[model samples]
Target chain A: MIDTAVLKQKLGDLDEDGVQALLDEFAAGTPSAEETQQVVEACQQGMEIVGENFEAGTYFVGDLMYAAQILTAALEQLKPLMSAGGGQAAKGTVVLGTVAGDIHDIGKNIFKALLEAAGFSVIDIGIDQAPSAFVETAKTNGAEIVALSGVLTLSIASMKETIEALAAAGLRDKVKVMIGGNAVSAETCEFIGADYWSKNAAAAVKQGLTYVS
Target chain B: MSEEKLKIREDLLAGRVPKRVFMQLRFTLEAACGLAGVDLVKAHFDPKTKLQAYRKVCETFYSDSFPIENVRWPEVYAPLGAKNWVMSSTGAMQHPEIESMLIEDYDEYIEDAFGTIMKKILPRIYPKLDPALPGAPLSFAKAYQRQQATGGEEVGAQIALSEEFDYAPGFFVGLFCEAPFDFLSDQLRGFRNITLDVRRIPEKVEAAVNASLPLMQRQAIPRNPIPGFTVFIPLHLAPYLRPADFERFYRPTFDKLIREINKAGMAAFLFAEEDWTRYADALAALPENQVIQFENGDVQKIKEVVGGKQIIGGFFDPLITLTRSKEACIDEVKRLLDIGMPGGKFFFAFNRHVLDIASIDVSKLVAVLDYVHEHAVY
Candidate 1:
């Protein structure tokens, strides 16, 4: 039997291989549910460490990438079991994508992970997606929240156009629209008639969840 | 030393640059380059061309001479497009059968899977195999030679020629530190996921960061010489991060990275791209002699935070030179100078890289510099 305390400490330490091994051990039916929750708590602690490092300027993009990798690994083990018991349905469904003419996916991907963890079912439309694609996907998925991300300053217009098209399609009011990315702000959100302007992925999910609820 | 070079360097050391010259130079460069002419690639071959052009434009407008420095000139190199894929380069995850073996818990397989796909497609889409390309083995040798020729003696010959020049110093050949969360949010995690991750699964986010620090630190070497000061680029952080959230998620990482870097005998330069006025005090509390360069941050607030202990750069908005009239450009520069120059330790320049635009007037920049140099106090 694996020690839940040890596993929790290892997860808090952000020990990828250790956590993975414990997860594997758990998959083999070694650890109890109580142990699994400990591992989850430890993982959360690890994120706080990451946040600290980031604020202090000790961490960078690559570190965040690796952290995400480790977290996803542990989550892989926990997500299914957590969902099985109707633990948390995503607060809402967000159909998110980087608008057309922009290939930057790092921001969009981060937002997706944050949103999913926040209990929102995120349908990522991928990068360089056309405006029509967003509207069509929102309609098809019946997604209550539509999130548009554009890093390129030039693509801000495309986001607006997408919003306009949604209105033209008579579906604008039906879905809550959120706009985010480096160039986006409260002013841009207002100018483009978006319901919310999220400065980061976390803020986006929070706002999306509220709107949906 | 030429007064121009000395003045600029002094300002940098003191944490501020005279405003008139800074504004004038910016306006002149903007006018001369136009939007399309600031070719980042060409600037690599001869950085002096851009510098000289700016100087010439300034001379034309204000009729002043700015001496060129013998300091190591800046260059640009190709990015190792595949370095990010080095871990997944083996295509181990791409095989559908192997991918299928991935248990539901290993969701990172999706990233591995996608990386495999992109690596396969890269060759077909951009099929140019130039040995001279950055990240190629030969490129390192070439960079070494260039460094040697330009009076760089310390480990200059060791630089890989193909390395891309992302910043002035480029990638340190030795040990370096980075904020882990920034790494994930800016370089790896698509923005959407990072934001969601921080709020929803803060634990997973923290764990991922911890696992990578040792790996990053392993890359750090003691012999690495950081010139000027350490620059913490908050480009991705500002638009996405809240002041309170920054205090929680980012401050600790920043503190650790700075402590380690400082212990290794280097200074920190916190470069905030967005309006960092809200978090200035938190940033100021880090270490002394640290430089804070703000892209769009308020100058007065930045000054108040650092309080003359550290250097501060950037108050002139790039948009002024890019879109506003030349007269407006001068006024803006003068405004920044009036406020920023009183305190020393200021290095002046546009908030960001000088973009090429056609309508910008170069002479205004020269005139501004001349006016500032003539009027600036010690």
Candidate 2:
């Protein structure tokens, strides 16, 4: 039996090789749905550790990035096994992208990984997406939330434009708007009429869960 | 050089002030030229027009507060098909397009790294350039040589311009060297891709950055010690890196680079681009007299940590400066001085400049700088 506590510890410690070694062991065994869910829960717990360490300055963005990679690899190994038996249902659907005129997607990608790990289906619209494209996608996909990310000051204006476009399409009230990036703040979120803003990836996923629950 | 300018330089080199606090005020050419009512597009292309406009702008705002001058260079505008700046509908000014990406695919980057960049990336960035055409490498070499020649001329011209107006010329070579990760992220792989690669294929990322260092050393490490000799290294991706990972990927090359610059008898102006507050303990261990210009970090905390050793250049918030009234701006300056100036190593500058021409209040900037110079003393 794989000691899941050890796996969680290695994942949080950002020991990529150790996590891989543990996952390999777990995969080689006749994995049941209960074991798979336990592994996924360990990954989430590991992410919480990564987030706490990040806040405490013991870890940095690169470390969070590495942690995300570990979780992604773990999921790839276990996702199929879980699907063959049973797995946690996705909590929500999020439509995410970097706002128009900004090509930076680091924060957005990190948030995507965290949200996915937290059991949310994400439709990433890619970078420099227009407001109309966002509105249309949200309307068509029946997305519960739209997350706009940008790292430039000019993106503040783009966020507002995206919100107005959603409102124009009569989809504003139907979907919550969340914003995250280096340039985003609570003040900017309020000004842009967004429902939420997070300074980091973990908080983004948590806030996203709150909207769904 | 004026006595005041010489004194400022001495104090800066010693990592301590003599008596009164020193201020290094900077301005974007866009802000200066806009103040002077010159068409930026026209001025950028014509050397005489550019200098004449700069001269007029300098005459208008040449004070103790306006000390540093970024010498104007005759820029060659991109052709119609590949223009990076688009003209406004009214034809009053040009706005820069979003920064274009150079590398389309990261999988091909290792191969492209070994291949001719002119054929691989340059043509994709600048549509006017053709990969099929011969002599691209020669043209690139000639352009580089021309830029070096013009850079020397620009320094001379700025010195004359400064003397003509009785302000010391603060001409320095902007030797931009990125940490290994940033070089890949900024130049070849986008941040998203590189972040993914950091976990998926860490060794490849290391190898790619290691391969690029030799070229960076040759290009970015200043060879000649001209007047106002300074190597301004703006560090990105450091704040984002874990300490061990940073030690592995960036610190070795960066330490060697600094040693090489110090051996050349040049001052290194290190710009801590993002929030490096977390790395204060490690950064404080570096050799002294380097000005680590903080763009977004706690002034008081950084002061307590690294203030004794290195020169702290800035902590004033640019957002406050841009949004606040003149009185509030001056108050902000006072607040910064209260926190940063007492130790005698602080210089007053905005965390960033108000690059939007219309948003720049020159009078407010002048007031804040003047207030710093008059009231901030050791």
Candidate 3:
């Protein structure tokens, strides 16, 4: 049996091969749904170390990036096992997109990876989406949380428009809204009617984890 | 008076203490148009309207000089049918994360940078540049000539108008260049692909960046340097890398560009566009006097590390000007100046470019600029 603790450390250290080797070994042995879930939890906790180190200035975007990719691959190796065993149901669905008028997505993509690792089905609508598109996507996906990301100033206006669109659709009351990007802040979050905001990716995933927990 | 306004910060660039903190500012084309109440699409296409709008915005915004926001050359991008750089509905030109080069082609690219870009990348983004289509080259050549000529005429007219308004572009680099790693991610390998490549094919990424540096520097740095200007390099990659990765992949090339430009007696104005608190020591290690305009970081830490070694500018957040009340806006300006002004080489500028008038309070912006112009003295 692979020690999830050692796997966590290896992932945190950004040992891509080591992390994969451990995950592959666990998968090669017909792992149980609970075991798969436990390993997934370990990866999530490992990403926490990555995020903490990023905040502490020891790691950076590149490290977080590599860790995200590695964690994603690790999760993929375990997904089949989890499925055969009817793994834990996803926590909830989160609809994510870069808000209209802004196309910057580095932060958005990173958050998506971590969110998926943390076990949420995220439907990422691509960039330059209109409020109508966001409204339609959120409604069709039956999203529990809508995450809007934009780095430009005009995106704030677009964010407000999108929230108003959701409100107009009568879906605003049901789904919590989160805005992430440099353009979002406490003041703008309030102005835009979002439930939470994050400027950086690591903190964003942390916020997402808190939302469901 | 206009000439002095244009060269307001030339003294600081020349290694002398100035009477006041020189405020460095740039309003992206759409932002300037928004401030002037001009339609973006119209101004984007019409050179005459854009020049007028830029002048009006600069005057009203109380900038000491005309901003090098951008040069609108429709003839260049329109005919090329550039997929990455396109006009957005929100009144700005946004570059999509598109890569023309495939990851497997790194060896071929490293072998011949220019040939690969010209032969492989340009044609893919701009199908009009495909050699297989006969006369495509001729068609593009004609467009290039017309674009250059029109660009020169428009810029001349804009400068003349700014001078008439009594504030002209102080020092502006007409050419745009990129740091090596930035070029790799932005131009060839898309961000997602490059992020994976950095870890997967680490050696190949290093080799490609190293191979491309000389070509980029030679093309960017001038033989006869402009006294007050340099090739503008908007840094996009270094801030994302950790210090070790940055030093390994990005720093050498970044240092070379700065060193080559400075050796020719001109300073390279680098728009460092993210938190660079990690790379302070690395920047400090480089030859000093490069214009490093930061976007966000601890101002006091930046002042401590790269203070007088380089001409430090930017720390004030433009978001504050957009979101805060007038009193709060001025207070933030005061805070930035209190930390940045004591150092002889420091100048004031917002960390991010002024993107548009939609989010920003025009009154607060004016008040903030007026306060900086008056109170941020050495």
Candidate 4:
């Protein structure tokens, strides 16, 4: 007999400790459908706190990384009990990676986390990924969206080549290709033939979901 | 005149020699001399020994010829070692053994070493250097201070140049403040936080901007001989930011910096390091004649916003250019030039530094440069 109102109140405050205690109470017994929704909502609240801290400069890469881990842990616990189809419906799948010759993954990882939280299935291909590898992964996973990540100025061309290869393979139209990284631009996106250009993780997730939907 | 010297001189005047070639030649020569067990100090005194070492390096690494032509070379620019030394010393000051040896205490020592090294090296390598060449003037502020300390008259700081050098000058400026937004999240926060902050904590953000403006304004001061442009690289506004955030957090700061830069009699080079497509209206509000070197923005949209007002540079992906074949390289360069190089004041290079790529194809890159020189119009 968990009080859903109290759980939602704790979640809204983004009290991680309070949310964790509420989660523990739910884990001890079967929580109703509304109670499970409260857990999901609590996770969202935690995300908001992380976002707030990040925006205010009190949080950093380490904090964002830890928040992602926290969300993942709580999500894993709630995944089984989540209404079989009641959880937000995923828009589509996106296969993302940092292009070859670039080993930066912080941006890509954050994008993946944001996407997952937004209820999109993400297959992160990691860094230093070849153009062919992106095409192969997209084809294998039936991913509707292919996202390329790059941080170095040098890797923009590689990202373009990947997009060109995707087009050459005649798979371009089937999948919406998005490019994000420090070095990419919309003109470069159009020049490279990518479908979308996003500056960071949150926008990438938003645009990715929109494209799939 | 020596054939090699004549060739290099011609290339420099034509701006055909890529900067990387000098770096590669220096690196290869150093390595070969080391491998041959040549004593650097001994060789410095003996012309014969130095020439012999050079010949060996040329023969083994740079082909068996006396001079290499149109070959791509590595660019090995020297960093501000004194700054690095200071930073490292400051980092180490936290330790028990060296806590007392603060960076300020080591300033004189660092200055002396830096000045001595510059004085010893500059005249030897760049005797006939021009101070007015773009990117030719190096910042040796520490070295100059050391010269002053060592009873050397103010002869002015020496400018190092070589016939084989190509210089592209750029800089990074902080876009926002450190008080309201932490530096780490400021670097990586997405647009969501950007938007929410404006709606929720506008006053705090404004205070941070106000506090940060003076520091950013100071960086706009141009101190070097060859007037290099100052480019402010902003990382705060990105995916998590929206048009409203830009208006609130970014616009006023930029307006202040632009005004300061203009007042200082310097050009403002704005390097937007994020996708600013959604906030084009805010970007367009920036002052005119300032160059906008976009890192990861929507190019067409950027062009629409600032194309007429500012000199736009970048958007080429350096990675593909490094790895692709010469044909592909030529095509990409030509295309970018057609779009980005149309208006005068438009300079081109890899959208960013080519940190990771196969070595730059010097010939291919040179070909693009030739095309741009021939075709670029205002």
The TM-scores, chain A only, for the candidates as listed are 0.75, 0.94, 0.91, 0.79
Candidate 3, residue A172: lDDT: 95
Instruction: Score each candidate by Cα lDDT.
Output: 0.54, 0.69, 0.79, 0.51
Question: Candidate 3's residue-wise lDDT over B1-378, tens digit each?
Answer: 555654556667765778777766777877888888888788766777877777777677766666646765555777777777776667578787887899878998889988888889889888777889887877698778878777786678666756666664544557557888888888889877887888889899998998788877787766776666756788887777766778788888778877877777766777888778878887787777777888888889988898868888887766665566889989888888888777578877777777877777878888898898888776
True-vs-predicted CA distance for residue B256, candidate 2, Å: 2.7
lDDT digits (tens) for residues A8-93 of candidate 3: 99988998999988987998887888888899889988988898898887887778778888988887788788786776678888
What would you estimate as the lDDT of candidate 4?
A: 0.51
Candidate no. 3 TM-score: 0.93
Maximum-lDDT candidate: 3
Model 3: share of true interface contacts reproduced: 0.63
Which residue ranges in model 4 land beyond 4 Å of their true spot? A1-30, A37-106, A115-150, A153-213, B1-159, B162-200, B222-240, B280-284, B296-301, B322-328, B341-343, B359-366
lDDT-based ranking: 3, 2, 1, 4
Tell the DockQ for candidate 3: 0.59
Error of 1 at B88 (Å): 20
| Model 2 whole-model lDDT (C-alpha atoms) | 0.69
DockQ of each: 0.05, 0.18, 0.59, 0.09
Best by DockQ: 3
Q: Candidate 2 vs candidate 3: which has greater lDDT?
A: 3
Rank order by TM-score, top first?
A: 3, 2, 1, 4
The TM-score obtained for chain B by all candidates, in the order given, is 0.61, 0.80, 0.94, 0.50
- Tens-digit lDDT track of model 2 for A38-115: 999888888888888877777778777777777888899888878767888779889999877666667787888888
lDDT of 3 at A207: 76
